[model samples]
Target: MTNLKLTRFAPTPSGFLHLGNVYSFIVTYHLSKKHQAKILLRIDDLDRERVKNRYIEDIFDTLNFLELPYDLGPKNLKDFKSSFSQSERMGQYAKALEILRQSKLLFACDCSRKKVEKMHPKGYYTGFCRNRKLPFDQNETSWRLKADMHQDISFKDLNEGHIVGKLPGILTDFIVRKKDGLPAYQLTSVVDDLYFGVDLVVRGKDLFGSTLAQVFLSEHLGPNAFAQNTFYHHYLLQDPNNQKLSKSAGATSIQFMRKSGKKKEDIYMMIGEWLGVKERIKSLEEFGRYV
Candidate 1:
């Protein structure tokens, strides 16, 4: 069996790909190359409301424009519809959810976001409904994992070194299954990473809390979970307000840049400048030379 580290650029195709997306992709791509790893381009199209066909096509367009190569993914839209879509993997998610349920690690939650925010002024859920033993009805309530709020979860990040934080302090009682019968990001991502054997996950530091949640899930899942995985949370690209750039915020996107007549080298140069690399780059492939 091959021992090559498996890394993935999992993008949620909810909107057009933006500069932040490019930056994170560059970081992930560079790290994968540095470690001699295989890359998988996984599309996270879980949120049906925001996921768009145009966004999916735009992902391929942007990656092609940057000349990024991956070892796995759909070759075309047809393949994507038939195989790579996350909605097609519901059975896998259901099985994982069943495992969690059987372990008695999950509890039904009926509180709405507004209600939770109102109950906890600071926004940290105090497990108000965890012990209510609410019935699990897809139409009525979401499911939350039984988090050890008092315990701290720590992990070794490749870039940040050792980091520690309390799960309750950093994140609220996270949803494993939405009341609308959808799998939560935390559950799907953990399941997907485990299934795909992804060893290195590179993304923005904003997701550090998310990493903690996933690590928490991995530990609870079993000994085999997280055995092959590690993470690298890189610097985030923020806007003028210092807020992280988001697709929903109408951040400058690759499609907009291309429409503005920006060349591929220009995009590389922007990344180089942000990363403080002295020499400019003409292509995404040349970015490694400067590093």
Candidate 2:
């Protein structure tokens, strides 16, 4: 055991809970148990355009249906809206943005998606607006970190130990604050983890690049616990075509399965089969053994 204190189930409410989401929950749940760390149900509902009440409701419903429990965070939709909502932490995000601004490591960008694509055929940001000196308060301008592409970022990996890498090309000069003036995921994620004192992070391997990005962003945010936290990037559950399951892929949604008459045991069995575990998995406890 790593003497961990806390971890979280940070789910986004842009779509219904899918099996992939449940798989993440199961891994988080079991890992928390193994390390004697408390679990916090942190819902990422910042994407206002796609967030829906029903999707938020589905998070609680699915957790209850699967009998997955957490040690902290909102117990229901009302509780989340009243206290745990990310929107409530706007001031904290703004504060961090100001710190980054004062560091002179941020620039205002006014490029649109089409414009970015036109600049780089591969769609990667070419730092087009780095020297444009656009005003941060300008309408439709986003704040981007002036990343040091040559600098190495290193962080502790719970499974693989120390990992070192440079910023991925796709995330070059990544946005810290969106054009809407709201903090972007990379910024808010680091702020929220530090806000809640999370020391152990378990997420899918697909976010490996994001992990590196956040670590680099944290360094510029001054001293923060996020950089010291250990991480575990679990393997993802992919489809037959070798594509990772997504919330947008409605067919894999737990809500759809429940509506179609699937039981919790059936859900566990499906996941176990997907993982290729030899023993049948009928409950969360049984699944923990394989985790």
Q: Which candidate is the best by lDDT?
A: 2
Question: Global lDDT of each model?
Answer: 0.81, 0.91
- Per-residue lDDT tens digits for candidate 2, residues 113-138, read 89988887777899889998998899
lDDT of 1 by residue, 1-291 (tens): 223478999999988998889888877787888888889889998888888899999999999887877888886677888998998889989988888898999999888878887887786677899889888874679999887566688876775567787664536668899888889999899888887888888878778788888888877775655734667887887654566777877637888889889988888777676666778776777766643
lDDT of 2 at 120: 78
Q: Where does candidate 1 have its weakest 10-residue lDDT segment?
A: 221-230
Off by over 4 Å in 1: 1-4, 160-163, 168-170, 239-243, 249-251, 289-291
TM-score of 2: 0.98
Deviation of model 2 at 13, angstroms: 0.2
Best by TM-score: 2
lDDT of 1: 0.81
Regions more than 4 Å wrong, model 2: none
lDDT of 1 at 258: 93
